[model samples]
Target: MTRPHTLLLAATLLSLAACNDAAPSTADAGSLAATITDAAAATDVVTPADAALAPDDVPAPERFSYVPMGCTHRVSAPVGSTSNFRDDRSTFGAAPDPHDVHVNWPADPSSTIAFLWRTDPGTRATVVQYGLSPTALDQTAVGSVGTAGLMGNQVTAHEVHVCGLRPDTTYHYRVGGEGHWSAVQRFKTGPAPGRTDYDVRFVVAGDSRDDVSRWRQLQERAMGGMNPPDFEIFTGDAVLVGFLQGQWQSWFEGARSAMSTVPFVMVHGNHEGLSVNYLMQFAQPQSGVSSQDELYFSLDYGPVHLVVLNDTPLRSDYEGDVLGTQLAWLRADLARARANRARVPFIIATHHKPAFASSSHSDEIDTQAVRRGWAPVYDEFGVDLVLNGHEHDFELSKEVDGQGREVSGRRGTRYVVTGGAGASLTTLGAGALQPWGAHFESAHHIVEVHATMTRLELTPRRLDGTVIEAGRISLTPRAP
Candidate 1:
């Protein structure tokens, strides 16, 4: 007899088959753009991908199986359904407006910007018109339709890449195709490639899966700061179930303001099951590390080099095999970043798991693969800062080595666990604090880091806009 989950999976497959028709021509006017249609026809609707939540076509791992440890009796149960989580008029504004509209840095921020958005199925096409002036959109680019196995239904996802843009210039842009368009938004580009000395700042936070209201509050405070971040990095766990389309919709709605403008670079948390939702949401730059996946990648903004890693060792092996793929890539990536220290003086690594979180999961006691695998690379390459989440509180570890010995800012790495965004706070146990923990706070907050040629400043702020703690690290000149 077919189990309930098997029956549900079959229905989901049928739905996917039905909705896989060719999308309407995305052809617009002279340059690649989509022609707008009437407002009535382009209503953006939230649709679930499946009746019961289950993993989609999970590709085989390149080296070994990519499942969490403790292999035993496996039951094909419905993880959960997406129907429970729905967006009910909280985020986004007005009718005929696009949903889940976000920008990302898939390439050089100065010359290229990638846009992603979702609309009603069969909307024909999507396009982005951008220019120096809001009224006169001199350049237009058309988008291609991609489908993701959302909730249990197949929904249309659109993406467009605008290239050949001027460096360090402000540009106004809007998204829609065939007639329906969104309100005009503006963004500034980073400095030209191969040049350093330009100051860089970004907000980093994560673990927003459980309490979205608090997540929305923290994001608003972070985005409304005096010196707004150039981009935002989510350490991981953007939603409770990474595969739930409804949860994603809610998250996008809550943080719409911040995301619609600045680019969001994300790392995949352990909660991000199978990573189907994670992969579908954003288009990322390809790193030639693993032929199996795009879980790990890098992005450069001004003088800062951001290395996003897949810390959760989903695959197999520990000592230099299967799961060691990322460790190998990280060493090489940081080597190149360190070599170009003059051009990219500050290298910050971010991932879901923390190497030294004290308030929440005690990394001191728990044997994390990240600490075992990546910590050595950070120490060897002299990575400046390591940003991580998974602990739902704020923690600042002193410049320390793998064994928790205090190392100077010149040669040591500072680890910050800024996982207080939207998730319930975790209290520090009586013996939780480690010798390297400089500060620990139980609050809903975000972390801001300012990178300059001579120094780096880290400030942790609460959801109500109060500063929790601030620290600065002096930059040491790169060796000749």
Candidate 2:
């Protein structure tokens, strides 16, 4: 049996040294490169700058690009801690006080904050009032409401985007429409984009389907920990059934502790079938990557340009290629990122399907399809890291190229599978390790990514507080 500590050491070494999988590594094959080249030549790619002129006669890619709305924090007397951190669990389901209060950055994180909440269907309106001081929350923001959940048990979903706020400052606010409002909560804005000298921390994990209690614990611990993450990133599978209103409620209830103060950057998983419920729920930045809903998009948080992809087959139930329109848009996005690498030096791509996993579902057709269609794009663009979920276990891969070859130095993409968040574990079968599999853990936990301009540090911690794997990748550049 591989003890947790030993597993952690092995994974860390493999990541830092850019190790390979169990199979014999090979160089980039000629055919795959040629295929990518041909695709590029054949497609009329759209750049971010030119995306706006997309003709209405033809379907233009849906995208939302953000520019920094710089602001200085108002150093008002800090609102008392009780007004900010008290648990609102007791007030849940009581009335218009709202349930499932969550935050996201659908617009500029520096000057805008997006919120989603649930209220009784009878509630007349959904609104948010926020400001620099708790007592003087005179500013008002109205939100739209929609119906969610299965037939006969629908709930009202409300979302708001509070614009024109200060950057890197704390603000107090409450949710509810008209006469009803919940307790005031606080959230801090992140640093402006293109600022690369500071440190950024974010929690990355997924597959919390059907395990609400465990998910609650993870949320409490993650938010309660010292210097909690700037935001939360779930690769996907937030709920067992994407269309189930009750499951969505359960997920929001479990995660409300952290989410109220931190924004959630979400992705779609196989479990998010049809994405009807998902589309109605949280609002994310539009990236023009997908003709579909918020299933695929991109956002810039500080210096990191994070691309969220919808790799699930649109017609089927989460089985297919990332080819066609999404791939072409992705290539264009990466090209833009590479051209402006100096401004945003770290570019990380995230999707719900894994390129490699040593679990029972490792060989799923969708995973293989994603590898075939998207891995070459990742390699060609020099994507720094690729994050994924879907497999119900933790597996971190070595820095492997499109052909599974171990690339040395600071090159190659590092892929990590962090699907252990509150999901049932998947034990590795004997001799099931692939050449790309560097570390595998069959436990429920979360992965913490500490990002700086020149380095990215990874630490996967079990729910019980055991550090299972730790590694660091340097983004340092060589002298000319």
The numbered model that scores best in lDDT is: 2
In candidate 1, how many Å is residue 226 off? 2.5
Candidate 2: worst-modelled 10 consecutive residues by lDDT: 74-83
lDDT of each: 0.64, 0.66
TM-score, cand. 2 vs. native: 0.77
- Least well predicted 10-residue stretch by lDDT in candidate 1: 28-37
Candidate 1 per-residue C-alpha lDDT over 22-140 given as tens digits, one digit per residue, 9 for 90 to 100: 11123212111111112123222111222223244643222211111121211111122121111122222233356788888756687777777776654535578899999998887
Residue 193, candidate 2: alpha-carbon lDDT: 70
True-structure lDDT of candidate 2? 0.66
| Model 2 Cα shift for residue 17 (angstroms) | 37
C-alpha RMSD between model 1 and the true structure: 12.6
